[model samples]
Target: MLFPVALALIVFATSVLSGVFGMAGGLVLLGALLALMPVAAAIAVHGAVQTVANGARAWFSRAYIDWRSLGYICAGIGIAAALLLALRYRPDLATVCIVIGLTPLLVWIPRRWLALDASRPLHGVLCGIVGGGLNLAVGVAGPSIDIFFIRTAIDRRRIIATKAAAQVVSHLAKVVFYGGLVQAMTGADWWLVLVAAPFAILGTQAGYLLLQRLTDQRFREWTRWIVSVIGIFYLGRGLTLLLGA
Candidate 1:
């Protein structure tokens, strides 16, 4: 009971953070979940809860989603999911952590080479495939996805909304990829998801309201620093575990 209560509170807070920051919620939630449960259980439960969080954010910010980008990205997501399903491949924890740790570093890639033209659909597809594959492996890829969007000229709201929309795909894939395993884990704690739903909704709304105050430029700047910090954290954690091993 206490665990559920605490987890539910986390769900609300992370959702609120994502609601305001438009990213980082998954990483925050994933870290918390990992500390409480095994990797498989953490991934599934994170996917389920994130589904609500991202879904609500997307709906709230639906006006700003780049439909063309979403279309191409969804196609790429389908392709990646199919390949993963056929191969029965998902990376092990050490690998997932290492990769997750490495992604934030991509932000440093020189813009001359890394910059993506927002009007192009192929970029979205490619990013989706890569990001989707990684999401399956690690359960979240917003940091990587953040690198993709920060290159474009789009406004912060659009970036947040579209990314939330993309995350819907990735989070859903996490559930489907870990389908049976996730279901089995949730068989006992499904109530936590139910109990946490409303709080998640409220939290997203709260974040949305908070986002209303920030200038677009500030949102972008803050998100970049926040993502880099998160990357350092994951990188450090992954490194400690590997070195200790």
Candidate 2:
């Protein structure tokens, strides 16, 4: 009872955070879910719920999407997905938690130095491979993918929309890859995904409305600090778990 209720709250809040800042929500969601369930189950559930949340965000911001970049990124994601299946990689919970917890810190990377050219298909593909693999492993690759978007020709709206679009594919791939692992779960687990996904959409809508009121610079400034704090938390928790193990 308490688990489902807590999950609902986490899903809503994190979705809003993703909606407003264009990322970070999944990191929080994964971190919280990890505490309540087995790593594989938590990842599978997160993948399913995030698939809906990102899909909704993409659809809502469909008009702003950058098609060319999205295409190349998708190609990369496909490759990564294929590679994952071939590898049969199954990460341990403590390691997965550390990776997820540290994800938000990618926000602070100096874009000026990296200047990843997303205009090139190879770059998008490269990001896709990295982001896609990371998504499967950790459940969210927003900050990793965000690095590719920085300094791109697309404006803020396009970045957010296109990234959301890319995430739709990323999360869906994650679900397909992780989905089979969860088939044995009780009906309650499916209920968690069903309930959490919709709440995530609602939270996203609320966040979108709030986003309209803020400037791009302001949005970046505010979300960065909050996400960093969350990153620190995951880092602490994950390390503690790993060491204790």
Candidate 3:
């Protein structure tokens, strides 16, 4: 009972954030899952689950996918995934926290000051590596990708679609790479996935509607503040875990 309820809340929250900000579901899911499962298993499961959710979203918004940008990003993600698998290395919790916490800050400078172009394949590849690697380590890949997209100045629908597409590929790659470790889902897990699916769909739809209602300037402002707040919280959490002070 508790598990189902928890899964629903997770899907709902992820949907709302993904919808409103055009990304973050994987990050939020990663953080929540880490508390409950082994980090590697959590990442594998989160990637598998989110692949389904994001795949659905990408289909729904198929009209807006930026194929050219996605091609480059997928290439980078593929390379990153291979590197991660080849190494089979896991970062310690403190290191994981710090890395996850700091990634957003590192990307922000180039995004805000350097005026990097998200539409560029190089940017997508870089974002993909960061996002994919972090997802493998900590289960959250949304922030870096979000920063990249936000910098690119894509409209709401396109932002949502393209992100969803990229995430779909990233998560699918993770699922495949980590397949040996992810045990078959128990009956209970499958049940949770089934129950969570519809809510995830509904939440994404709500997010799309919300995006349609907000003006471009308002959307940009909202995204910036939200990303900043999330980054600060991640940093604080990382510090607490790392320093234990």
lDDT of 3 by residue, 1-245 (tens): 78878888898778777777765565667677667766666666677678767877888889999888888788888888888878886646556556666666643454446544558978878878877776665666746776677567567778779888888888788767766665744566556667887778777777777777888778766766666666676677888987784
Report model 2's TM-score to 2 decimal places. Answer: 0.93
Model 3 segments more than 4 A misplaced: 106-112, 150-153, 183-187
Q: How big is the positional error of residue 140 in model 3, measured in Å on the Cα after superposition? A: 1.9
Q: For candidate 2, lDDT tens digit of each residue in 87-142? A: 88776777776886677777898767786866688899988998988998877785
Model 1: per-residue lDDT, tens digit, 1-245? 68878887899899988997877777788888777777777787788888899999999999999988888778878888888888877545666667777787766666677767434688888778887877887877766676667567788888889888988988888887887655447456667778888888889999998999999868866776777788778888888888888
Q: List residue ranges in candidate 2 displaced over 4 A.
A: none
How does model 2 fare in lDDT? 0.82
Model 1: CA > 4 A from native: 182-184
**Model 1: pairs clashing at backbone N, Cα or C within 3 Å:** none
Rank list by TM-score: 2, 1, 3
Worst 10 residues of 2 by lDDT: 178-187
Q: Compute the lDDT of residue 102 as modeled in candidate 2.
A: 76
User: How high a TM-score does candidate 3 get?
Assistant: 0.86
Ranking by lDDT: 2, 1, 3
